[model samples]
Target: MSTAHDDLDNEHTILPSWERNAYAWTHSVRDGHIESRRMVTDGAIIDVILDGEPRFVLDLGCGEGWLVRALAARRVRALGVDAVSDLVAQARAAGGDFRLASYEDIIAGRLSLRADTVACNFALLGKDSVERLMPAVASLLEAGGRFVIQTVHPLVAGGDHPYSDGWRQENWTGFGAAFPSPAPWYFRTLASWVALFTRSGWHLCEMREPLHPGTGRPASVIFVLRRR
Candidate 1:
């Protein structure tokens, strides 16, 4: 059984785990080692973003700036923001416009950025941070703009755990040996996610499930939202 204290501790460990594995993660992303990303979720997110016809995009929690580069390739102006210094350095070295700011900083209005769309790709991994971050993100979007999020499908990611929202440990199975300590993430059920969006003053305009080719199950879920 897990206590609220344990949940808090796990949430706190998320950033440090990423800090330690930043290099390994960058390599994996650039080298395209993650099969699910290489085949499905990457394109799924890019497609969704492009479909929005966004002229300017903010890649929230953009790891290593791949999405920024990709969007830039399509002639869409983009800025990638991340809390990990090493990852931001790597992104800058790769010619991406990257900023180093944590979720807390963004929530506190540290970044004065506005965009037609804000994309968070597989990065909303916490409990409180995410809940608070959403409203702040809404302030960063232009009118008639959208907030897009891609995350592992709750049904698939839940595994054998109970179908409820809480903190869960990541094993980082396919990420190889370099990731010594995997981050623990807060899992939200579909209903919880919907409720969060409402509470954060957003309305879910669309929801998409991108499927895994082999398993024919959803690999991830994308939520497209508009300010309420």
Candidate 2:
């Protein structure tokens, strides 16, 4: 739908230790509200999908493993994975079994197990990573399993300054998302976002644009994808 939103990959590491670095940035900016906000949003999504039942889950990019703990508390079989080792260890200690590896390495063979749901919440990597990750997400889901993702709203990513349009970005892996420059993010429009799901062989079943607490404008777009 969108020229693949594919055909590109990052040669650089982007941002090393994204788990810790992102948390640091969030804590700094959100002033201890990052975790709470993430929990509320993520829990809300997970709840509707499960419908008051215990669902087997894989928490992708599961930093600090908070969701894993939440799922486990609800008697759900929750497994967590992250690209950062330290985060994995901390996650494992918190509750569920956690692994430190990229999505490719895990899905390649090591953790080839499919689950009732695969979730990547509040962890929007650049385009290349998302492209790479989505395929694996599809593969790791049982028929009818859900693939839910919450990313930075593309509108929000493209900052709007009064005088200028802000630095426009056509790609997600650009300097901002991959660095600590406090740079603007590269968000996906609603149409483009749906196009990605279609191209990836998934269908969007649920959608929402919950407004930010302070800002009256939309804060985020949430999606629930099912294998086609």
Candidate 3:
């Protein structure tokens, strides 16, 4: 059982953990070891983004730039941004348009780019960054643009734990032992997610639950939102 202090402390550990595991993450993703992403979330996010027919996209927290490359191949101009230096290097080496920028950098108005679509694929991890980043994302959208987010389904991820908002530890199960420090993620209830979007000057346009092909349970949830 985790106390409030532990949750608070865990929130601050996410980035460092990612920093330590960046290489392992890149390898796992490129090798197609993340089963949920390979079998479901990847296609789900792609379909949602392309559905809007956006010519330009900005992928937030784009690890290894796979989403950017995927969109680029489909004729959509995309730029990938991430905080991890090694991941950015790997992405650039792979011919991806990646910029190394932290979430705080983006929230501080450092990025001067706009796009018809902004996508965050399972990257909104921290509570503070997410609360501040949501409103900032609105400022980076072109006219009539959309923002798409794919994340762990609150209900599905809740499991035996209480369905509330707080930090949860990630052991990196099935991701192999090379991940030395698995990041702790903050979980938000379904209602909490909607409230956050509403307060952030955005409205949910659509919500999708992508089911795992084998288990037939929601593997993740996608939120398609537009600025209010």
Top-TM-score candidate index: 1
**Candidate 3 overall lDDT versus native:** 0.91
In the range 1-228, model 2's lDDT, one tens digit per residue, is 222323232212433535435544433323434433553456565665466253688888777787778788778898888876766666666567787767667547667788888888766555555655666677788877888787656556546632221222333232232334332223456776788788878889888766666666555667888888
lDDT tens digits by residue: candidate 3, 1-228: 457677668767888888898899999999989999999999999999999999899999998999999998999999999998988998999996899998889899999999999999999998867999999998789989999999999978887888888888888888654788868888999999999999999989999999999999999999999998
List candidate 3 stretches off by more than 4 Å: 1-8
Inter-residue clash pairs, candidate 2: 154-187
Question: Number of clashing residue pairs in every model?
Answer: 0, 1, 0
lDDT, each prediction? 0.92, 0.62, 0.91
* Candidate 2 Cα deviation (angstroms), residue 33: 3.0
Q: In candidate 1, what are the lDDT values of residues 72-170, reduced to their tens digit?
A: 999999999999999999999999799999999989998997999999999999988899998999878999999999998998999999999888888
- In candidate 1 the C-alpha lDDT for residue 74 amounts to 95
Worst 10 residues of 1 by lDDT: 173-182
Candidate 1: list runs displaced more than 4 Å. Answer: none
| Rank order (by lDDT, best first) | 1, 3, 2
